[model samples]
Target chain A: MAHFTKATSVHDWLDQRLAIDTLRRVLAKEYWIPKNINFLWAMGMVLAFTFGILLVSGIFLLMYYQPNVNLAFDSVNYTIMREVEFGWLWRHVHAVAASVVFLIIYIHMLTGIYYGSYKKGREMIWISGMLLFVAFSAEAFSGYMLPWGQMSYWAGMVITNLFSLGSLEFNGLVEWIRGDYVPGQAFLDRFFMLHVLLIPLAILALIGLHFGALRIPHVNNQDGEEIDFEEEAAKYKAGRKRESKVIAFANDFLSKDMFVVSIFLLFFFYLVFWHYGFAMDPINFDPADGLKTPPHIYPEWYFLWSYEILRPFPKDPGLIAFGFAQVIFFLLPFLDKSPNAVPASRRGIFFWWFWALVIDMIVLTAMGKLPPQGIYSTIGLVAAVAFIGLWIALPFITKMEKKV
Target chain B: MKELKILAIVVFFTLVTYWLVEPFAHSQMHKHVESEGFTYKDLPALTKKGDAARGQELVMGAGACVGCHSIEAAGMPAAMDPVTNSASYGVNPPDLSNVGALYDAKFLAALIKNPAHALKVEHKFTPESGKMHPMPGFYGAGGDIDQEVADMVAYLQSIAPKVDEITPAQAFETACGRCHAVRYEKWTQIGEKPSFKKKRDELVFETKLEDYKANLTNYMGKLPPDLSMYIRSRGEHYLSTFMENPQNLLPGTAMPRVGVNAEGAEKVIEYLEDAGDPKRAERDSVGVKVMIYLLVFAAAAYLWKKEIWKDLH
Candidate 1:
């Protein structure tokens, strides 16, 4: 790697004065990345870029959003939409970006599963990613309440009340989470703090750790092959780490990442500009009324799969199983004990099994969107069984597929 | 250089989008009549202040709040003919037990001045005779009714319990006792026992003993609906907006506007919530402690992870 800046002398002086060269080496230059990775690998950077947009747009929204129960909805409708310059655009971006970020993350996770990126040393990275997913879910939920619309209030009530399904202890825990027996100003105030400050800071720290963990083992490729770190270390001179045929992250991959970001932004901005309310509930435009509830109370689409998972069984067991479903993804590395980390392309049996889970997820999502009645209940039950069944059967399936 | 070019294109597109969508975004401001008038920032501070006693007086007397609204605390009578009123006004006015907790004080004052003014132009009084709100503006222009409206709002607030302090029994009594009898024993205890002749007259209204029943001369001659499980039947927020202007929320029914100010509406809402679920305040308080615990737990987990993985690099 070479320094392209014309202020080379100044940079060299700074390097000598502060020992800043090593920082540049580790963060900017010497780290090697696989040359064969494709567009799917770019999602991490895309997510980071999108997160930056959300932060910027969210700041603009926070400027006008009043977390008080009486003023919240009106603040959005009047101050943000009418009074502030370009405030409407920023609010729409903040909202629509939440849904889009979830979409990107879902695809990224799907890619990881297909390429077996969660295997072995990368398990912590996968786990961190899962934790981030949970944090993101919380962030989205808390942020949804800032508007204090009809949907916001009812959805907050419905989702928070889910915890009461547990025993006496669980009911106590639910009360603790809600801050009140019902979703009131207290709940709104607490959620506002979380959405604006606390959870976002945690997410930022988790993101830093996620990338740090990734740098340790380098990146995984779609081919599901390992680059032997010990052998590479041995090949290098005593003090220097071995380097591979690599792409410069700042020059090459950053360009690719930015290009994808620009294309994604085109669509994102289109939604913000033309179809701003595409992902929002119409009832949300109205101020929250404790006495009037929307006809249907459901979460945003990202949560529909998990919400469906809770539909099949009795209340407590269903909620526990729903939680386990999220936890089960973190245990994937241990569950797939086969020695080989094979991509779906080469592993025919695992490929079918994986798609089956995908299909089950889709079916469950559909069932979740419908009222749990008659045939929908039966369908939801079947999909829920298959979802859990796939996890239980993973190790055996992996072992059985050794011949492939 | 290529990255810079792509960045430039993205910036250009964003600017274009901002320009193109300005009209649509700005148009949204004028879309809802509720969005019209002064925001909280523009409101005079006095609108938020009121004397509950004075407000109560206005509600019962000059404001005519008692005519349409049935308030347990004030002991306001039910409408003469809820069925006929429902037919004329579009829907039956709801009781006012939790009105203070539901809306902003400024909104209450604005709505009281002109009932149709609370909604968008499309939703306001239509030329069709039955589509308009029965509520007449109580203040403005020739007379400065600010203090009166404020007092009425204060009285509404006085009736509602604190959000955290409401009990299910209190909620049921305040919000539902007027129309619905929850427990037979409780009903018998609360209801005034009519004399023998009066009971017979009441029976005649139900049984239609003769062609000309005394209550028949009343509007539509319909009894108020039972509220035994209204806590369960009506969704949250229904009564809040409904009480503001029944015609605006649900058109083509006989429910006249109840004229309970915003503070009063909030009290009614609190009562409704308390009736449905008594444990709300407790739940919210416990939630804060749970959040603090989770934050500490998260921090501890992060530190433990750092300790375990320190050598991995």
Candidate 2:
């Protein structure tokens, strides 16, 4: 308490940089935004907002959620299906929000990547966004096993086994995460805490940092111009007076973003209300039966790509060689020599970014949908190779030669 | 040059993260065939082989067994040791002081997998092990048992128990102590019965037909079934996994969540998966080998992509 001494005048004696006023000022509507940023920009906020909804809905579910493996399934069913009146709604909202968050975040990521959002001063924002994605996945994995369903149990089993593959005396890894082998009461309870508490806390902290990094100055247009802030502020104030418009969240930006939000909300709402939320598969309702493996168990769609990758690897086949040969995306920062980033033409290059994005999403989606091995695995190999050669390396070379 | 260094550093870190997290490589590098849809990475063979000696230290000492079990130490007071995190989770762990000579690895695996399944198989236990605790089926019970199970199993095989090196009569006395305390008292009254050991044998073998069938009526019986051949037939670590969730074998059984740790289940299953079935065992090794190879290939590929950054260009 003593450390938080009274502020010295308008400034603090301490070095706490962002007071509420400063935060508000930084986010002021009058701040110059990129003129050409279209509906695609809405996705970043949509990702953040949906995540916020997920956090709220998740908390409600957590209040009644139990992690006792024996009771985990029953407890989930009682609340979502029986006990709480709007429990189903809360549960469905959480489920749908999860899907929505992923959709928005993935598209947001593609937007940032293609447009060089990771370039220049914006690298930290991209990094934070990636971190948000990883944390969100952690949150999802923890929660997926909370219901103690067959898929949850089997999924946990399959993923956990990946740790011990080819020795490395990796059983300890499972114990470290699960606090034991197999997903049990102890494992589920800890996972529940991580899903509901720890990851969310980490995500909020990272989100704060993410937006902070986003507040860094943005580069403008194909010529790499800077926004003249003082001139823009003067123009904004004059226009405010001429129109006699007082900007309130409701009166100005909300009115516009509201229409966009309503459109997205309508689709989301239609899906939730009309179709039943994504289901806990029938087989999963029964507890995990180890001796009796399920006939066909697949991971959730989001993990399909990675799961596909794991389908064919031999246990002792040199892991580093195979894994490295295939999953090159994890090391992208090294492969390209876009020494000068901050894409000079955010508007004109939209076509290149668009096609690149389309190719990626299509292939990634196809790889995910297909069975993991044989022809499909071969296809994945080919496509991944093609992605590197065509979309990344070739473009980089072309762009570099042009500059030279 | 400065930019290149930064790129190099980024490459190094990305490789490190990828190597640490070989997300897809665990299964994709080989022609792995799982009869079941799921597969395991046949984990790398132990480079530092566990000394059966050090394994002993792990079981009773720092491994913190008593920390999550109903395990009793040699000088345990009459009161129950507070339940372990496992037992609080509802597992009824077997006492370990003299267990070494009593049960083989396979039988022990069942006990280790989940006490409920062990009781169901070894004792044909009808009643629930105890009231439900937070415990649920563990390691062998589900899809996610990992390598730590093998370590714990290795550790379990190294432990001494509450009873070992016993004559059949002594075995009867020790095992039936929980069920026939008064009968045991009467038999030891020193005058009428031939001898306590003799009487115990008679109680075991003599109570054959009517009592054997009738024991089914009330779940608790005077004797646990012979476990000698039980482990023999169950296959490596099969006992443990099956024991973790015995309803897999005997549906509608009364075992409530008894194994707490997936490792506990795996520990038991490694023993069971090994010690039990030898028929077609050598045959399955090929498939297991294939699985191992695939995983290794994936890991290597992942590492290569992560580290070298390009094909030796």
Which candidate's DockQ is highest? 1
Q: lDDT per prediction? A: 0.64, 0.49
State what share of the real interface contacts each candidate retains: 0.00, 0.00
Where model 1 places Cα greater than 4 Å from the true spot, the runs are: A1-19, A228-245, B1-313
Error of 1 at B266 (Å): 35
TM-score of each: 0.57, 0.50
Weakest lDDT window of 10 consecutive positions for candidate 1 chain A: A236-245
lDDT (Cα, tens digit) per residue for candidate 1, span B139-176: 53333488778877788778876744654444444433
TM accuracy, model 2: 0.50
Q: Where is model 2 more than 4 Å wrong at Cα?
A: A1-23, A165-169, A219-226, A240-255, A276-283, A312-335, A339-361, A384-401, B1-313
- Candidate 1's residue-wise lDDT over A107-174, tens digit each? 78877887788876888889899889989999999988888877788988888877776554476766
Q: What is the C-alpha lDDT profile of model 2 across B125-183, one tens digit per residue?
A: 33565443222334432322333334445565455433323333433232322222122
